[model samples]
Target chain A: MTTKMFDRIALIGIGLIGSSIARVIRREGLAGEIIISTRRAETLARAEELGLGDRYEQSAAEAVKDADLVIVSVPVGASGAVAKEIASSLKPGAILTDVGSTKASVIAQMEPYVPSNVHFIPGHPIAGTERSGPDAGFAELFQNRWCILTPLPGSDEAAVAKLADFWTACGSNIDTMDPNHHDMVLAIVSHLPHIIAYNIVGTADDLETVTKSEVIKYSASGFRDFTRLAASDPTMWRDVCLHNKDAILEMLARFSEDLASLQRAIRWGDGDKLFDMFTRTRAVRRSIIEAGQEVDAPDFGRIAVAKPAEASQGRD
Target chain B: MTTKMFDRIALIGIGLIGSSIARVIRREGLAGEIIISTRRAETLARAEELGLGDRYEQSAAEAVKDADLVIVSVPVGASGAVAKEIASSLKPGAILTDVGSTKASVIAQMEPYVPSNVHFIPGHPIAGTERSGPDAGFAELFQNRWCILTPLPGSDEAAVAKLADFWTACGSNIDTMDPNHHDMVLAIVSHLPHIIAYNIVGTADDLETVTKSEVIKYSASGFRDFTRLAASDPTMWRDVCLHNKDAILEMLARFSEDLASLQRAIRWGDGDKLFDMFTRTRAVRRSIIEAGQEVDAPDFGRIAVAKPAEASQGRD
Candidate 1:
């Protein structure tokens, strides 16, 4: 493990990303003492039960006091509130960063509250599962994942390097980009995909011709892949949608236009057009697999086991 | 293993599904001899090299000459031509089936050419990976997966039972439904998901705001999952879209309407609506997992591996 980079590191919002940070900090000995805090009492209690930190606090303001580094990990919508809550408590010269999905909105939300003496860098780890909450995190969560840091132009280089070191110790590869550019990239790669997944699942649920049970039964064919993203944390995703409206809307418009063209191809029996489009997309998956972004297994290497009793309900 | 279901089984179009059937039939001793055929010479040669069948033939007619069971596993659009090519050569009392995703269309395409003496039953196994071709097949591909049979109203009961038995021996649970209903069920569960995935990937590729390298680098966030389905067999999916046009179009309309509402919710910052829609979709995924239709593990149980050299190319 690396030598402790900070005497005390406070973690605000002990949800999936927060708890993951706690675990990694502890695993890598990145901080001499870690303080965990969240708004919800049960979540705080759960983190304590899991022994996720050296100390647990119910108040973010209390958690930040005396910390050399503070990482805020909350829903994007709540970043500003958390910043306001902990603004006065932030230690001078401390590096304060957030693990929110949207960087531009986060920088805007927290920058006003951050003390001029403090170094506030906005970051996002482009990695997650469908699950949420304290129990859903592990030290290995960030391994091989990209953690993008969108630092302001005038930010202190030394503090940025320190924070980058902490993340590097946690097993992430770092990339730095402009906050607005980060938002646009994530809009297509993350936010839009989740939105599309949620929309499709909602459509299937509301279908009058096809029963819900049929959708569930036959999901393995293809639909289940979309469901994984749709089942992500609702509050977090809702906040993302609200915070990154322009980028998400722009990406969504492009997606719809493309869908209309594909729909026309199917309707008009344009097999060549469909074939060419489908063929071109295959290379993207290959590149992802080759880049080590995706697993190189069919169906994500899912193994079929005996059917559960619930499976019988859907069968005729 | 079960008693030999047929003296000889002819598999036409030895791609993912066809070669998989060949492997399972060999594994289970379901047929005394297996004959594989495809219009493409290289695929037939590869199937032979893979030892997928006891005999190989370039002509579908020759392949089914003395086969007691015949499975046409080509694209749905090719069902008619394949059926016509092998019709006169099909053995008396032989059971003929196709594993096409779209049932009504396949039946309509092939039923007119089937001889009165040959039993024609249209079947669809709701199992596959994004990977295709002979190299992608596996013996256990159908294990515990649902296989639906949509036989004609007056199809011989014994013939249907025998085909069902053959699938059972290959480790599938059987469900029988009307061809039209099967088409509708599949439209929402399989066709729409593939179409949406293909559309989104195409959109990302065509984006001017976000570079292709950025999308590939940040894909693990969510976009990577869609790419797997998007990268599926172009000919097969194209045929599915064209053949199941009515059901697909109907589902697409519903999907577009739901997406519009979701887009509005995002535009209006309707957190409650977004949260409710997102929350309801989680239950569908849970049900699928409970029904043994999907793996319960997070991120499809993918293990994070060391980043490959190619991954560095996309980084700034």
Candidate 2:
């Protein structure tokens, strides 16, 4: 067994991300004790029933009183409120962080209330399935995934390193970037994809020409791919949109502009132009798969052609 | 062994769909003789090396000469030429069909060349992985999938029944509809999704703020989902765009207009509107999952949060 890294770890907002951290911390023995806290009484009760923590607190303030590591996993829009609530009760020299998707907004919201003695680092783990909630987490969610930390200027170096080490122990690779850069990168990769997916699914849902039944039945062709991202937690995504407006708007504008050009090509029957863009984008898919960020076994990744089974093999 | 249903079967394109038909036919013993032909000699040779057919021909005309069932699985744009090439050689009373994604344009292209003696029907199986090649086929590819057949006016009922039965035997449920309706259905479910996927992936590739490496590394968050569709066969998709122009452009116009409204909501921080759209889309995902068109597995398809493993269980 490994030595415990923290005497007490306090988890604020026990949702998918928070509960996942709880599971990994327990699995890795990263903390001597875990204190779980969330605003929802039912979710807290559920977490307690699941034995996700050694202690449960009904208030965020009470939860952080003696915690050496405090990780807030609430929606970004809620960051300021949670930060203020726990500010007076935070342990001195403890590392304080969050698992929000938008870094700049989260930092702006939480950094002000954090005590000078506390290390306030902004973080986003680029891992999660479409499911959300306290029950929708697993210890393996962070395996081979990336955890990005945006440390503010003059932040304690030892605290940042400790936070990074904690994430590494949870089976995540760590990268540190400027908060603004992290926001921009995430805007294009996560935020825009989810927004586009949501928008397209909404379009299909609102369609007058096609039946919803047809869309559902034939979704395997392509539409279902967008549906997975579109089905992500609404409250969390709405917070992401409101918090990262500038970067998301910029990415959305670019995506719409590119889509307009593609629509024009289709109207004019420009097959070559259409083919070039479609083919070039494939290199990025290959890059991601090679980088080990995507499943290579075709799990909607790229169904590598298995050998064609002949006469003696196949299901009826 | 199952009895052969046709004296001979001719497949005019040796790509993913066509090779899959060959594999399934061989596995099920549905054809006494399988004749495979493609314009590309390299692809034809690969099909032969894989023993995907009982016979091979360089000319599509030669392939169809004695065949009782001819399946034209070419790009929609090339449907006219293949139909013209093999029209004279098609056996009388034989069933002729094509597996292009767009049914209306394919009918327009191939109908004029079909002889009076042949039963010309258009079909599209709503299935496939991102991979495409003569080698990327399995008999199980069509299991539980939908295959829509668009029969022209005065089509022989017996022929349609035969074709439907063939697809059923190959492990697909068959639906027949008007050509225009099939095109419209496919536009929303298949064509628009591919275009949007290609567009977003293209948009991410051109971003100046987010490097390609950044996009690749953090893709698991959402971007990788779009890449799977974007990496699909470009030639097939370009034809889908060009041939299904009216319906595709219609969907795109609707999509862009809806996106503008969504954009406005985001710009104004209309959290309720954003939340409503995001929440509404989850129903569609749930419907698709319940329809069994999608994997119930969390595989990028909603991780159901396996019970969080404790210290006694889990990888380090």
Candidate 3:
């Protein structure tokens, strides 16, 4: 693992994930030279100020030229455009990947634009914070997180392994699945949560019954939990919703169906049903904690640290 | 300010809220004697072990005997029964109050049992964690939170003010609203969030398509945020659902409608609509932060300290 995985690694969008990769590449010496290209002039300037790359270019084509590895870490909706911008200049056999939320859409948007000479492997590093932009990223952002790669069928296995190794070096565990499965799983795990968060926050905003002041003052009661997800990069989430339409809709249908049943239980005063559903859900939280995906508290990733009382433990 | 708010304070149901009030009573010396009562023997013993009260009793009637103030901190469904148990034992001119989520239902259920000699006031402290039971309480649990009182018409203003004063000493801001309005507001802000979290987590749990391990491992992507609310006390949440049916239903219906619209937007690739919603919700988070109601993170209240990255405010 000497610092020379590739002679040049090009990052086409220096936002949260992109700048994060830049930091890790710099720290781990993963690439001899890091070329950064972003659409926004300010962002490019900021990345340069942050010393995020060895070379900064406004043109994606210029950044990708002669680069052995090129990662387009833009929003899913921009994948096609970025792919098209850099495709002609991509070096032969160069591995081109993306860090997008929706895989099927990213593949669909980017696949046709990728030249046959390049190894086009779509990827999603399931790591981020609510913040965005070049300054919001850090080298340790991907630590212990999951990165899923949806390489095309009949694609070179060696190329896929190489990308996986790159993510591994950046502190992520790698997993592979079909793009469709990835979309469905993500619809439930990532996309749905973000959508629900945005929806609930919107509902609160439109509320006339509860004064806006009251919603803000009493948010810690539970409403605030959704706010962080709700406050994520609007452009990115919008793209996620637009790109992963069918899977997201399917997940939303299932979610609404389950919600309707739960609502029925509440309406009928079915304590047993409510209790059963609530109790069962607790197990999933515990499993997530055991699997190291979540912390073992009702308020994870917050400023308050509550110690669990032994006597508070019940069967549920 | 000197902490002698009542001659004696009886807490009838030493769960999280009950024990929290008890802790505050002890810390502030607000009561000459703190009498704690719950139906469960184990909980009573645990409260005694924790020194949460000056006296521990299984009978609500016995606990209320000779007490000048009584706080019924129980599930909404149990409010009537607890009121009945302590009705005869309530001292004349005593201020009788309750900490129930659904103020309207609690008032309806318990109003009949409160004798004319006692001043009955219903209040809801908009603060809690997912954990419950006597041992899960702390004196500062209500600090900087909202404590809403929904008093019946023509109720004793002095008694209501005194209760408000007590909550203030425990570090909560006070708000007064109609009982039905309080329930509706709570339905949207708290009840619905819990229900949705429980429902979504349940749906993910029942998915046969995605392996449980995959869901757990990738949960950090977003799904883990829902688990904290889903892991909240089952009995308390079940009672809330049953008692706050109308308000919860109203909010749930509205939530569903909004979600359907969002789904339609996603399906139609309406990125602008999604972006607008996401952007609007960010303002709510900002308001909550300014109101000091929430920490600036998704999984808040779980961690004692935020990462330094959160403090600097630059990353995504």
Quote the positional error of residue B300 for candidate 1 in Å.
Answer: 6.3
Worst 10 residues of 3 chain A by lDDT: A307-316
The list of candidate 2 runs beyond 4 A from truth reads A300-316, B301-316
True contacts kept of 2: 0.77
Q: DockQ of candidates 1 onward, in order?
A: 0.52, 0.47, 0.47
Q: TM-score ranking from best to worst?
A: 1, 2, 3
lDDT digits (tens) for residues A238-293 of candidate 1? 99999999999999888998999999998899999999999999889889988878
> Between which residue pairs do clashes occur in model 2?
none
Q: Residue B272 deviation, candidate 3, in Å? A: 2.6
| Clashing residue pairs for model 3 | A131-B316, A132-B316, A135-B314, A136-B314, A136-B315, A136-B316, A299-B302, A300-B299
To one decimal place, how large is model 2's interface RMSD in Å? Answer: 7.0
DockQ for the candidate 2 complex? 0.47
| lDDT at position B268, candidate 3 | 84
Task: Looking at model 1 chain B, report the run of 10 residues with the lowest lDDT sum.
Answer: B307-316
